[model samples]
Target: MGHVTFFGVVTFVFRHSAGCTGNAISSPHRCILVPSFEIKGKNSMPKMYRTKLAAMVKNFPRYASANQPPNGEIRSYIESAGHTCELRDAGEFQSPADVVNLVSEHPKFEAALAIHLFKAGRLLMDIEIPFGVIFGGTDINEDVKVEQKRVVMEQVLLKARFAVAFTDKLKEEAELFLVSQSSKIYVQPQGIQTDVTEKFCWTEFLRSSGVRTEHVDELRVFLLVCGLRRVKDPLYLVEVFSKWHCENLLNVLVIIGPKIDPVLTAEVETVVKRTAGVFLAQERCQQELHAAMKRCFAVVNSSVSEGMSAAILEAMDLGVPVLARNIPGNAAVVQHEVTGLLYSSPQEFVRQSQRLLSDHELRERVVRNGKLYVEEHHGVKQERETYQRLVDTLH
Candidate 1:
């Protein structure tokens, strides 16, 4: 997309042509003109400018341990747009001043992107480069409710050239605090692509996770993938799930993800060890994890909050049904009983799960609908185009 500049403000010029060759930028309000420059070299190679991505990174063991898979996917999309990105741990910085110092030290970077308002976005405020904040689940769902955090977050939002929310509901929540900049906030769901290991062995994976050999033939695994964190509520249905398994002799709940919180990891270990039909699988890369997810009966999300879960979308893309908590985030994506099942309480969760398992027609219908939803709304190509346009607009 062609961008125009007026006194250092970036404004995109929209064109109407069948063969338009640039990105189509979308915003909640009118585009502003800003100082703009070319991001290409004489030889036609896309000019490379460093882009810093600030986010949490402590517990994950996969690529760029501090950033989650969604961040990784975003990074890849940014690179595809011809930019170099460096991930800085938002959790490691002690204060906003520290974040400013870090960005100032990297003079080559043209812009910045921060994930989550309180931890990531707060630090990047007052920095020289034009920065945007991508709202994480807690940013709108919990942190905005805190007076102290809400104050800092509002400041960040005002300073930011733009802000991103994964859903319209999340954008509305952010607008409740950032009333003035509601026009700068855009709703864009995370994109997803599911790929599994070529040589995955379902029987071996089941055996390794402690499923009984005799029961493997009839085992109906319900995979719960999340880091061992309090917000995830990974063990929410463990006790009841174990009881159901004992009675049914086929149901099992397997929890898998990185050990993000040490204290929660210990708690999960203790609870999972004592609970029957509940196994804690080791953390694996996204590809391997998706492989395991495909071998299961369904995927369960018990998170207290979510910023448009990549895992849930991936499950849908992989043709797996989802059973998620009835929170605003999940509810926004899942059309309860059509795309997936949504539960408001533990008892409701068990009842819904039972219904999902017993009714094959319901399961197939939900999975089919969920797959269609993911393809229509969360396609990777759409996400890449959106980010490319957003980045292109940065001064």
Candidate 2:
């Protein structure tokens, strides 16, 4: 054994000749403190393995940061499981060679995990690294509809060592693209950590947004949290609310999400201006957002598509019933009238909203069931264990 130094929890090889067998030691916590190495020759270069992670969207920090999304969640899980991992920005890499250069430089990285297959599949082929892929919404829903994206996605799926999806529906969809290795498909839902506070600061948020707390006292408010993008359909409910706005009804729709697409943001603003009682607001911090979810009568998701929506799960975790679109992703979590109500069109959405708003018993029952649904199915511990089992097989 050669002299070793601690870098972090994991071990690293240092100043060793090439072609030497290195001993990598990991603690029970999966922290690598010192790496083992064998020297081949003074001229031989050290081998390094790098894991590259990618997401198509840029504003993830606004909502997810280090706390949300299974991507960040799995990164933490893998790190705690005793692997030296690095999160590479696949968005920053301009070309295939750039990605190849980045991944090829890292030593001891035997495989890489891509959050979405489309982003990682081709890159893995270019670099010739064993890659595991996870499916996102569009990959199975919209992208597969198009011949080009579908063909590319199929190639990626065929090349992947294993593929993960957020729902069983997605796993079945993956079977269509991955004709050869259907057994490699796995279903892993996104996990959320709930926040509980006796005091909620809705008054402060309303004040900052230029709405008087006095006005809030008399009105029924509903909160919609999602990025302003085509997939999310942020303006759908705003359009529906325009017809129902009445002084006697005294209801307001507050849409709060990061402005992702400029065109979509402009369209949302147009709807907000045209629709009375519809307020378009910027994104809120997790604490504030959770508080809003707690205070609101119901949380809504008008997404045209999704892969196990985190927003729906979060709302459910907070004992808030959901009003979601009747899509595969929404149906996977919400049991129609059992946990939440689902609608097909804007008119149906209004009808469902009317029923939930007028009936207190229905609302309370759904809220109770929604919370139970999240606790049983989408807990953070359950998500972590699933990934641990998958990675344990790899080791």
The whole-model lDDT of each prediction reads 0.65, 0.59
Candidate 1 local Cα displacement, residue 195, angstroms: 0.8
Tens digits of per-residue lDDT, candidate 1, 188-274, equal 888777779887877887778777657675788999988777778888888888888788778889998777678888999999889
In candidate 1 the C-alpha lDDT for residue 76 amounts to 53
On the 0 to 100 scale, the lDDT of residue 238 in model 1 is 87
The best candidate by lDDT is 1
Residue 307, model 2: Cα distance from true site in angstroms: 0.8
RMSD of 2: 8.6
Every model: Cα RMSD to truth: 8.7, 8.6
How displaced is residue 338 in candidate 1, in Å? 0.7
TM-score of each: 0.83, 0.82
